[model samples]
Target: MKIAVLGTGGGARSHIAKLLELGHEVAVGTRDPQATLARTEPDMMGNPPFRQFLAEHPGVTLLTFGEAAATADGPVINGIDGHNAVAALTPIAGALADKTLIDYAVPFVYQHDSEHPWPTPWGVMPKLDPCDTDSLGERIQRALPDTKVVKSFVTQEQATVVDPQSVGDGDHTMFVAGDHADAKRRATELLKSYGWRDVLDLGPLVCARGMEMYAHLHSAIGFGLGQQFGGHFGIKVVR
Candidate 1:
């Protein structure tokens, strides 16, 4: 399988690494390849530069957004910022039509006062845009009517997305939601390939609202548990 992972962030690096480990040929797509390569310093979150990651993984291809999708023979994973996902992928509508888009983006904007810790974050705060009525995943689905948009990885960070087994006993459950059953199943298969032991199908694209909203708690938990744990846990279903 040839996968196109769109973005040049920590998540994109992890996706490329994991998918490659699963024996899938992967191409990382970005809006600005030059600027991405020019980023010599680590990201604010302390993730290494995308260029460095690309060098480390020689098997992965670097590409412009359109080229990545047009050349991909398999699913295109959404690794861009959630809010910017629709805008980024819309231009490649023809390439993505009738294909499954495994979305790992999250629509979050943190707002916090300076009085907090070294890196204060109110944790995504509240945004009506990614709430019950609308969500980043839903918007992408609406943008590409023919594309099957399955929302996954919204509740986890880059590290967690790649290695679910590294967390505790690895019983934590991942989740996905999409209008198309085939797409959801494909998403689940990919998750399983990456060693995600459990995946719950929440059903329908609208259910992404809950997943997107879960970002708040995800952010809170990261800091709450301290850096040692590193936001590496997934939400599990008790029953």
Candidate 2:
């Protein structure tokens, strides 16, 4: 399958690498392919430039967001920055029509004045907009009525998400929720390819509120575990 990974960030890179290893052709999307490839320094997240990544992994194509989506043969992974995702994706809705879009973005508002700020090692924690009342997944589905949107991979770091066996011996649970049953199945199939044995279908895209809202808790747990940065852990829903 030719998969379109729509970002050049660390999370998107993880999916791209894993997809390539899975024997799928990958085309990465970015706001500006030239700018992304021209970067000599690391990104804010410390991930190397896209050109370096492409150098290490040959055969990967880098294209504009619209071009990448239009070329994908199957599922599209939405890894665009959470806050900017809707605006970036809306213009390319036609290319995504009728395709299963696995969106794992958390809507974070980085610049906000919180009366009671939750400070983290990096800075104050970013607040989630459209948080409890609505979610990023629902918003994307609304914006792209023709796309089958599945909310997933938001609960863990993308690295852990693509390699479940790295934590708890692959015993942890992954969740997927979407209005489209076939889209959820496609997401589950991708998760299985990632070695996830227990994927919980939480039913309905509304459940994405919980998944996206869990970002703070995820950060809290990371802090508690003394992991000041990207948390390398997973949660299991044991019945």
Candidate 3:
């Protein structure tokens, strides 16, 4: 599968690394081609761990946002944060028409303070003003009516999403919500490729509200447990 990951943050990097590990043709999408090349080339060549990882798995190509989206096969995953996701994907909107889009985003506004160790306040942190009521995924779908937007992996931590083994706990589940069954199936396959063992389809895009709220609870748990506590929770099924 040819996958396009759009963004420059940890989320985008993690997805790129995971997709490469899964032996998928990956193209990183960024607004600035030269900047993306400059940023990723060093890590691909200089960073020992990244270099080793790439050496083990070749075929990951970095491209500008437009090129990546224009060339990708099937679904394209949006790894950018809520704040920049729309703008970053706007250029590729036409290309993304009628394509499945796996929207992975959390409404998290970073509020850092030296005196206060926490990155955000106790309540829910609003990353995108538009996501306060409706989620970014829904907004993206609204923007590109032809594009199938399926929301998933928003609740899981970046480390957990990339390297689930690092958690050392039980299977970490990811929730997906989208109206289209075909799009959901595509997302399920992609998530499985990324080592997601358990995934629950929470009906349709409207269910994303609950999923986003669940992320808030997860964040609260992380804050309460402190930074050192790095583990995820999963729901077990008994038949």
TM-score winner: 2
Which is the winner by lDDT between candidate 2 and candidate 3? Answer: 2
How far residue 120's Cα lies from its native spot in candidate 2, in Å, is: 1.1
Candidate 1 accuracy as lDDT: 0.81
Tens-place lDDT per residue, model 1, 145-228, is: 989999998788877777988886678888899999988988888888888888889988899998888876776687677743
Per residue, candidate 2 scores C-alpha lDDT tens digits across 141-220 of: 99999999999999999999999999989999999999999999999999999999999999999999999999999999
lDDT of 3: 0.70
TM-score of each: 0.89, 0.99, 0.79
Pairs in clash, predicted candidate 2:
none
If the candidates were sorted by their TM-score against the true structure, best first, what order would they fall in?
2, 1, 3
Per-residue CA lDDT of model 3 for 1-239, tens digit only, reads: 78888765656667877777777788777677665444434342143333343455477665777788877886788877776677667667888988888888765455523353544544324343444578777877887788889998777766577665555453656778999999999999877766677788889898877676666567567666664232354433333
- In model 2, the runs with Cα more than 4 Å from the true position are none
Q: Which candidate model has the greater lDDT, 1 or 3?
A: 1
Best by lDDT: 2
- Candidate 2 lands at a TM-score of 0.99
